[model samples]
Target: MFIVSLIFFVLFLPSVSVSYANTLFLHIEGKNDTLSIYAETGTQTKSYQVKRLQDIEALYPLLQRRQIDRNSFEQLLRELGIEVFEPIHTFIESSSEIGFVMAENLVKLPLDLLYVKEIPLFLQKPITYSFTKINSQNLQFSNTLSALIISDKTADPENGTYFLKKLLPSSAEYYDIKDINLTQLESIQTKDVILISAHGRIRFDNNDCIGLGDEQISPSHLARLSPKLVYLDSC
Candidate 1:
């Protein structure tokens, strides 16, 4: 896990091609009853160590429940000792985009979704997660480029695209599930951007798929496209 964390940090280091100001990369790993923290920026890098708490295994399951146990959740927060990890919190505040890589059971507990001191981390800034190494070359794009948003009636791509209109070029396109097919996504060019706000599910066999109302798009299908950006807003 530590090795994987190092590989992630190396991707955005100032020495890397994608290094940007106010960008923070954090990796949290828990193993052998200890929690390891690693954080880096364009100018600085820091590491910390803390003991893993008892019943930490239960925290993720509680979060997964439809009705969360507030008291238990808050107790988990207190047990995690966010205060003792003050340096990480302070670093996160100064960064714009956060790249979080969690190891083992830690991945089930979404750190960005948590509310610490009445402020959720995701609300504070743009937080992105990764399960594998991030390629810096594929991560850069023009914010003003035209976009293509695909969604179903349930998720409402209209409102979602409208909310993102400022970031997209005037020629941006919107397609409801009924209007497009999985094959169409392969024709996307490098100058285009794609956003899918639809239903998504991961099967036990590790086949990741997103619903298109009438069909599904899989990871293999997505790999064949070369878009400037592809945002998956579904669960």
Candidate 2:
């Protein structure tokens, strides 16, 4: 019986490990033209996609030169009203042809949805993206009335917390929590800004992103918590 139990445990161990390894906790927020992607690895979380597409696309050629094949390059040019080259087959054969096409036909045109909205998804850290405005001014930081910075023990010990701290006002308080427990939230000073920078997923359901931390909090719950201001920096 002991020998049989050992064999069964050995067979299942790899399966258990694979199951945990494949898990990717992601958060998606926004409606219509706006959307955000938040990803969590264990206790650490990062947020992206709240900026203008043109700015984000500028970083793409530097990061993903290899991924831009000839076909992709031509598609980009046609969208820009540049005359299509006749020798399509020759371009596909050359490894560096896409770079030349991009330089000639599409270089001057502003970044469209293909470059700005899509390419940033492939770049390395710290993942950069923009946020939606509570008010009308999207370009400036005026809409950012309040912010919160949450630090978990397992998160990046350096720049993660530092960036949030720098972005938030000196008046905003910082919190160190192991997880998002609602009981802990009660202690947060009322009418103060609330920012939860933690490892969790925000799901888009029925137009609003549902906040699921240690406890599941709806967008409405967040609105009620601080009527004046609320921002979730969760991943």
Residues forming the 10-long window of minimal summed lDDT in candidate 1: 1-10
Tens-digit lDDT track for model 1 on 129-210? 6653343434455666667777676665356645555566475676767888866766765435566677665333455578
lDDT of 2 by residue, 1-235 (tens): 0000000000101212222221223343433333344544333445555433243234334233434465655455343212112212222222211211122222222222232222411121111121211111111343344544456544334536556556665645566654545566545554344544444332212332323344554555555445343444433
In order, the Cα lDDT scores of the candidates are 0.59, 0.35
* Count of clashes, each model: 0, 3
Top lDDT prediction, candidate number:
1
Model 2 local distance difference test score: 0.35
List the candidates' TM-scores in order: 0.64, 0.34
Model 2, position 85: C-alpha lDDT score:
21
* RMSD vs true structure, all candidates: 6.9, 20.8
Candidate 1 runs further than 4 Å off: 1-19, 29-35, 42-44, 49-87, 94-97, 101-109, 130-146, 162-171, 186-191, 202-205
Return the clash pairs for model 1, or none: none
Clashes of 1: 0
Question: Per-residue lDDT for 159 in model 2?
Answer: 34
